[model samples]
Target: MDSGQGCVGLSGRRNRCRVTDSASVAVSGRPREAWIDVAKGVAITLVVLYHAVMYLDGVGLAGAMAPLNPLLDTFRMPLFFFMSGILAATAIRLPYWQLFRKRMSLLLYLYAVWVAAQTLFLLALPPISPDGPNASWTNLVTLFIRPSSNLWFIYALPIFLTVAWLTRRWNPLIPVAVTGVLAVLFGSQILHTDTPWDKMGRYLVFFLAAIWLGPRVRRMVPHIRWWHMAVVCGVYLGIVLIMVKLSLTRVPFVLLFVSILAVLVGVSVAVVVARAPGFDFLRVLGTQTLPIYLVHTFPMTALAAVLMATGVSLPTVAATALPVLLCSFAIMFALAAYRRLAAVPGIFTVPVASWVDTSAVAQRAEQAEASA
Candidate 1:
């Protein structure tokens, strides 16, 4: 099915296009690409850094890092959800029922499992508050209903996915128009309510923008010059710095727009990095993002807790943030390794029997045999 300029075609027999192929062809299956993974890598690392800072603040060092936190907030999770929307485009090509079941179910499983893990981890630790809430049964239940922290992304994604699916047939401008209205409402504080709409209002725009404009974004990549990206990055950094200096931290709509710009900058950087001479590490990090996302929070929080418990001095907090970030990466690496080891054999690796076009594999095999 072609929706104006955008074509929706069956991604694969798996009911969704592989992430690598989502942007390559007119819905026809194609080999996967690496730039998106690089983008995802950048987004996930920013998330870890954001959490690290949050952990530092929880340990009473927020005052020291307050200058930098606002700038970080501009891009952190906006890049994340934007990338998610890009990734979601792959499944959006699938039949409605299949798309809903696959994407929603996968997210639901991951969210449920991690939420349970988080609960258990807190129970084992001393009583503490990460974001101004006391540890109690009511708070715990509240988390499931409306997540109060980083976990809210998981809670909100399913809803966004559903909205995108239902509104798939509507004019793309509809979402954009709705997003503009919501931005106005949110910026003016017209509702005088604390509903999740406040939070949802901020991100739904980016999410829909990503889904609706993903193809156009992908097509522009090849034409973007190095200087164009450099200029965008410079402007974005300047805006962020000015916002921090002016102490304009309360404007959600402004931040939301900045976040969209950040996505553009991030995606541009990813494209350049993917085509550059080196930086395999970013690609590796990106591929392992799922495990990183799941495990980074705990160690980051635990590190801050330990520091606070020992009554660490303030000056040391700046130095401590880097270590906390490293520890989070280490924890994620360990979990990823464990997951790889525990996966069923065929599930962990590409199946040798499933390749209908085996010329590339056969050629590689012959080369290996000759080398041997």
Candidate 2:
């Protein structure tokens, strides 16, 4: 994902707003559109809810909401990575060293910090059996070399970015074809290994597709009519619900294209909504997504533990879902508030000096002088 710096210059205003405005223009010739933010907000909330429900159900306090959960899974991560790709498209214009320092460095730092935090938490807590075998020291070492788990996205992103940079000049179709082949191989279970490269190979399809298709997607915004968007959403919902009813196991492959369609639908919906009046909640939630992503797990985990301790059986699907949703939003709101306060000078903002070149700024200034 692009760093906050990539969103704007060292202007007094926040960069995120600038980036969002730019993205809106790319979509519908407007600045500061609201609905794209809403789509992102909704996607992140779905992720938090999915994790929360799974954790609660894992402890036997709740039964599976498999039907609804499966449907929700179709678009959650896809929307996220797509949004990241959209943001990263802007960052790609920066010099390589600046891009590495700003984007890749932050991802690495977060991955290391979070992995260490998870390891320490696991060690200090009771030795509950994991869903799979206890990850061996060898496996953990390997994970560092090439990450697994949800954290793998962050680990794999730099590689995707590098490939994107290298292949930037090639026909975008070439990378799309290559990534498709890789996805098929991985999805079919042919490319089996614990190696990071193997793991990267699996996810690179979606990541690269995001990069390759970003510009095309941006250009398509104008042609997307409201009725067309509605039809797409209807079809997407129908397909997902049908798959869920059929108890589809390997649905990702089928849903991959659907997910791409959903992103377009999402962008279309955002453009339409953003043009309309008043929906500040979505913009607020969207702005807070990164913090929510980082911290929502803690509250969700705590809520699960509390429900279990109270002997509350979330036997009904609704019971299982409501707490999870509530806790996730609560955590998001709390984190948003914290980030707002932390934005104060010398409080929580880390002050690393970036080595980004301002040649664009110089060029613009020189052009203005010449014109005068």
Which residue pairs overlap in candidate 2's backbone?
none
How many residue pairs clash per model?
Answer: 0, 0
Residue 366 alpha-carbon offset, candidate 2, angstroms: 19
lDDT of each: 0.58, 0.55
lDDT of 2 at 291: 49
For model 1, the superposed segments whose C-alpha errors exceed 4 Å read 1-30, 61-66, 127-134, 187-197, 249-253, 314-372
Query: Per-prediction RMSD in angstroms?
Result: 8.3, 5.7
Model 2, stretches more than 4 Å misplaced? 1-35, 62-64, 126-143, 146-148, 192-203, 245-253, 276-278, 306-311, 315-318, 333-337, 340-372
lDDT of 2 by residue, 1-372 (tens): 222223222221222111112232222333433554676676766766776666665555444453356566547766766666655655555567766654465455555655665555444443232364323445445556757564666667676777777777788789878887776565445675755455466556666677667667667766767797788789888877776678552544664565666666677776666555575566556655554655565555555546554665544766656646665575666576555754443222223333222345522322222121
Clashing pairs in 1: none
